[model samples]
Target: MSRSGGRWADETIHRIMSMTKPVTGVALMMLHEEGRWRLDDPVARHIPQFADLAVATADGGRAPLARPMLMRDLVTSTAGFSMIVPLHIPLTGLVRSVPVAELYRTLDLQGGSLSRMVERLASAPLAYQPGTDFEYGVTHDLQGHLIEVLSGQTLDDFFAERIFRPLGMADTGFELDAAQRARLSTVYAWGPDGLAPSPPSVTTTDGSRGSYPSAGGGLYSTLDDYLKFARMLADGGRAGGQRLLSPASVRLMTSSLLPAGVRQHFGQRLDGLGYGVGVGVVEDPARATAMDAGYGRGTYYWTGWLGSWWWNDPASDLTVIGVTQQEGAAMAHVGLPQPGADLRALSAALVYGALMQP
Candidate 1:
């Protein structure tokens, strides 16, 4: 018996959707360690295409940007990139409209490479002024492009040679081989009666590599493989006997990257947590909701669009990762309640109850 009938074997590979964001953050942090760029640097300084980004006005018109987007904005997901909040709260008052989100889908940027995505995205106005608000759109995918530009390699190549290979996450990547594809778990949606197989996702990977590697939500990883990555974060960015990032950098990545006056709520009473580089930082644990679920105040974590979850707690020195392979709420732009959202709260309660210590 398992959460999804026959559950994923320990070695089974599953697509770890937005969970990919933190990995992208780690990759960018690697560049940060090399001093490739600074946090306050204007994103246009690196990705020149975004230099003239416009802001979409409510009346269907465009306006000049009030301020330039920064590297910090990208890291914090406040770059005004028309966040994709599906059943997601705490969005930009500007670009978080149904039309803009639909606009992102209309562009079908996922079908093309990040470079092309950049060219087209630059033509459209941002949902809001950079750094003014938080919207969780293509910031990580943009980070993927930034990684490619800084490292002068394709996103896949850089991830392979740097993070995955170094961490011994052999089976994880944007694309899967035939054997790995065989193990890719099927996603399900809860229907009226019970669980039903989900329709094929456009973001679903084929057996071959893709030109448009989604840094935000495109990576197939096994439980063991993702755990290796999580353990590395818990170990201060060291694994496989290699030092990937400094403890200071890890702190920066996990600390609250949001500017003041930005809402941190994610619906479902998740207001206590704050957004970090590519994950959620457990800030102000005194507040209730998912913010306090990590069992420690400084714990940092994130999850996938489908059904994978993970958290790294510095206080307790613990890392928890689980996959359920359910994909419904994310695909439903209507913001349907995530069928499994409550399970996380329950699971966390049970896990912390057993811990018996902070």
Candidate 2:
């Protein structure tokens, strides 16, 4: 995983990894705006390959799904998709090995085309009954395939036409051009020995193309470009005099959608937080273990694998972006926080703590 060498600047491009999820969510919601699907619609309705979806049992057996995997489950990350990956994340169950997840790894399901990925995903059993638990996994990749299905365009094309183009995010795309490649920063990882530069596992191909337009964790962007996006959702989905989603859609995206039993999986760093369509919602500051958690309710945020982060405070119309070319979620042998733990809570405390006094 080697990255091109460059010094970061205001225009320096980054592989803003998991942050791409919310953008994919926006694309799907746009299709929803077009009346293409319903929240409760069975995922099988669109992808019949999941018609016979199954769940895994502790005793090494498969059971029928408790209910159909719903579209909302995909958005909220409770869709029961397996979360196993080669690298380690700090969350529980995310790196756990199970038969279904093992299937995912053995097949290298993420390394292929979206259509093939979905077909393989449908063949594996879910980690739990749909909506019963939350494990950040391959569900959003399914959303990428869903977008392709409903929009009749490739994921990259759809993003450009409906999102990046509409918002004038000229610097965001799944692939980098020759100029962009030169501007991309060399990524680093924090180790017990201290910070060290490392080659990224992903990069632009053929100077302007990428192998995977993965909805789950793939996109290159700049802070200036993504701020335009975050502000749009914060301002009720309107940017540059065009509305990509209605106010209602924005609410659904920012409001906490995680259920009581499931949110605990977010673990301690994100205590009192809830998930809303690929972002984390601040539902209860009091419940947060961090002393500095001061975000207003409905402030939703997300971070990237390489420490790229953003949050939108709709209350005050404030949006913040932070970028570090370091691995936010290290391989976990040294037990670093996933997505730069304490980065958001501490930042919110300082920023909001000042505003309240003034």
Candidate 3:
């Protein structure tokens, strides 16, 4: 068994993968609080490149989109864009090799910008449409791009000033400096092949090579720093006596925004699982049978592409962060013990064990 020897107070940096989504979500909400945008506004209003997007139909053909994508759609993964297609195929890699500045130069949606990526995606068939079904993909990455265009600040800068700086999340951001990199935990994945280190490309965000800071997946943080952010969420967006977001905004971000029957569209029966703006909402704790968390309503959480996971349980005024690194879909099918599930179980056990001690 691989063990992380650090505690929540340790200043070790971790590669946070998709857990970056919640931070990006908070950034958008901060913009919302400032009246920079609204949930219902068409994304095209700011991102003109999406003005001519189309939706892919069942026959593998494209048609004009029925309506413009709303800002909220981007947050909820209902924007008709996806990172993967059926049979586990990736759709586009346009942004994979391009520099960040060059990526934003194209307006035809045929290039690598988030708007362009969505435009190309519009040409591909959607698993579902706007506000119809929930799919996890690059929506939050697009949100990060929107933050850049709308706020006129790079995603990293905006997050640092508005979210990280205020919340005392000192060890969280897109890239790590030398000091932080020295403390970064190595990422590992267990495949049928054997236990191996995750690729430096997959694990490190040193950014010495000028890689585009992917707001969606590009971030490194420490457990304690992240716990600060999570605790702020548990405290309704206040940290260190500073109001990072309004209580209403925090509530709105965590509220279930999916329409009825949307969960079924994913083809998985997540009995009590619902999606909030950017995090997973635990609606029925019992249905999370595969996880070790105490079943409860209103438990909001998310996980990283690596094995990291965190959740905020308001009922207990408690939050937990479990850090590790293992990658691939369906941890059970990956021929190794599922690190995420184990971490969740460990967290739950710790919480319960602490309670029993009292």
Query: Candidate 2's residue-wise lDDT over 74-137, tens digit each?
Result: 8898888877465443334343335666677777786678888877877777888888877776
Those runs of model 3 whose alpha carbons end farther than 4 Å from true positions after fitting are 1-9, 84-127, 192-194, 201-210, 264-269, 288-292, 328-341, 353-358
Residues 256-311, candidate 3, lDDT per residue (tens digit)? 76767665123234456777777877776776534444635788887776677777
Least lDDT summed over 10 consecutive residues: which range in candidate 3?
A: 94-103
| Candidate 1 wrongly placed segments (more than 4 Å) | 1-7, 84-95, 201-203, 206-211, 265-270, 292-294, 328-335, 339-341
- Pairs in steric clash, model 3: 14-221
| Candidate closer to the true structure by TM-score (higher is better), 2 or 3 | 2
- Estimate TM-scores for all models: 0.89, 0.89, 0.81
* 124-198 per-residue lDDT for model 1 (tens digits): 778778777767667888899999999999989998999898888899998887777777777776668777776
Order by lDDT, highest first: 1, 2, 3
Regions more than 4 Å wrong, model 2: 1-7, 87-97, 200-210, 264-270, 289-291, 329-342
Worst 10 residues of 1 by lDDT: 328-337
Whole-model lDDT, model 3: 0.66
Number of the candidate with higher TM-score, 1 or 2: 1
lDDT of 2 at 125: 77
